[model samples]
Target: MLQSYETLRQTGIATVRAQIRSGGYASHTAGLGRNLLQANLAIIPQEFALDFMRFCQRNPKPCPLIGASDTGNPILFTLGQDIDIRTDVPAYNIYRNGQLVQSVTEIGDLWTDDLVAFALGCSFTFEHALIEAGFELWHIANNVTVPMYRSSLETVPAGPFRGPTVVSMRMIPEERVEEAVAISARFPLAHGSPVHVGDPAAIGISDLSAPDWGDSVPQPAGHTPVFWACGVTPQAVIQQAALPLLITHKPGHMLITDVPDTAEIPIITNKNMPR
Candidate 1:
């Protein structure tokens, strides 16, 4: 029998990956493997691999490069002992010439010798830390994907990859915002702290109800929207580049890794604590 989402959260990472690999679990990966690292996927041919690596180097916040597979290889040895990139991710967004062609549960048929898979750090890695600190993430509570937006903020361009930065939004209580920021900053690989807080208009986001990706989460009274650099920025940039081929993990459908979250030990300082 398939385990409940709540039950799966308490399960081991390998079991979760197994379920995902078999097409048994095809949902957003938020709140799963709370202590494990999760990554965003960006697979392209070796011809554009160098440029993509440079792009990630130039834009570290949204594209924190964690691991990459050798050309034609589907195994991400650095992330896990048995992760097969072709099937480990719950879903993949296929693109041809920068246009989304389809979304699929697996990409084994498309895996080729010239393809190189890059894994970028995802903000989902730090979500557990936020929850442990008593911050409420409504999307997870409601079993929906976190809301993501394409902001007016520009990314540092490299090669053919350049586009406005993408961000994930979380509605946090106004009073606990500072602690949330401080706690999250410890996970730099997870996009670190929020890039913007409060007022979506300040960052070129005009509608809170309409998101470019993921589900629109509720905004309760006295809560403020906090935005973090999102790994999905690569999808937007790759779209602009119009590459002949591109495969990325569907937004919020990430590859959970065997590595544990490397969040730094929190410093007990009065300044960082909530007022």
Candidate 2:
């Protein structure tokens, strides 16, 4: 029975990667690996590596650099022990001249000697932390993708990278807003804390139900909508740049890492709320 539980626990991650490698699964990867760290994928030519690295350094909030590969290499050693960039992710978006041209399951045909891959920290890491802290994540409960919106806020630009920051929204009960804030703030890499809360339209979103990407979850009754910086921001910027060729993991289908989640959270406060 003990071994059975272990197998069940790893099933989601293993099955998803297997399907992705076999071309059986191709869709947004939300709520798939609930406990593991899921990463946002970004692949670029070696010609733009130094400038892009500086861009991430300038705007750490939206583009928290998690792991980077050597020039002309696709294998990310820091993320996974045996991660093959060509077939590990569930879906791949191919862009040319900054326009999305095709979406495929793998990019073995497109792998080149002058390419570099970057794995950025994703919000799913904090979602696991939130769940463990007893907060109810609406998207996970309802089995839908978290709502994402393009915000008016602009990131610090570098070279050809410049665009509005994209944020992911979650509906939290009003009473637990402070608790949610305290829990998420611990993760500085995966977009720590809420950027904006309360009304969606306040951040330039005209309608709460219609998100630019992913399915919108119902805010309902007494909950307040909260937003955080998302990993998708880099993808948006890349699309706007219109490079000759670029690739990224499909939204939600992240690259799982070998790094333990606890390594990211150093301090824990049990006071609940200050008196």
Candidate 3:
């Protein structure tokens, strides 16, 4: 059986990495690593690195770059002392010419000298904040992956990378909307605040029951579906570019970083939040 989120909090980061490294644990990381920062992963060939980096720059909220690897380096030393880009994340999604081709626990076999990995801040960061502040997340309370959708909004193009913005939704009580926004805003590393609140249809999402990625959370009475820019935006956009290979963390399987959720970094990975 998979470890419960509460049980995972007791498991240290090193042990968590060990479990994943050995192929013993391959579950979503929503509630694991309680006080630690979590990151979304994106790996691509060196030829596409600069443009991908620029793509992230043009779209900061959905693709908040937290840490990136030097081309050809498998380890991401900045996020954690022992992070191995090839094996740390629980699962990886391999995209071939814009389509998901496979999901694997580890990518060591496919490691190449020309690949660069990028780590982006995740919504998991603010989840810690919400829980700490006593706000319940629709997905976590019910134990499901956060619901994500393809929005009608278009991202600023960077080279061949461009697509509609993707968003993750959480149904918040009509009352706690401000609190949800305030808590999340503290962690700019995470995709900070809601891009759209109240109505999913306004953002071009027609069905709350159906989503592009992850399972849909229950939308109870007295709640509004709140949407935030998601890390998946870059992967979706890059996938549209039809790259030979693009690697990203399977939606909820994030890299648990050693850093605390509130640690203010001098530089946010490659660039600052767009002004």
lDDT of model 2 at position 228: 91
Model 2 over residues 53-114: C-alpha lDDT tens digits? 88888888788888888877777766655577899887888998988888888999999999
Give the better candidate number (2 or 3) by TM-score: 3
Tens-digit lDDT track of model 3 for 1-275: 35555576678887787877777788888888877889988899999899889989888889888888888888777777677878889899999888999999999988899999998888998998898888888677666789889998889998899989999998888999998998888888888988888877888999999999999777799988888999889888888899999999999899998778887651344322222
C-alpha positional error of residue 20 in candidate 2 after TM-score superposition, expressed in Å: 3.0
Clashing pairs in 3: none
Ranking by lDDT: 1, 3, 2
Per-prediction TM-score, please?
0.94, 0.88, 0.93
lDDT of candidate 1 over 118-229, digit per residue (tens): 9988999899998988887888888899999999999999989999999999999999999889988988888999999999999999999999999988889999899999
Q: Which candidate gets the maximum TM-score versus the true structure?
A: 1
Each candidate's lDDT (Cα)?
0.90, 0.78, 0.85
Give the local distance difference test score of model 1.
Answer: 0.90
Q: Score candidate 3 by lDDT.
A: 0.85
Q: Find the number of clashing residue pairs for candidate 1.
A: 0
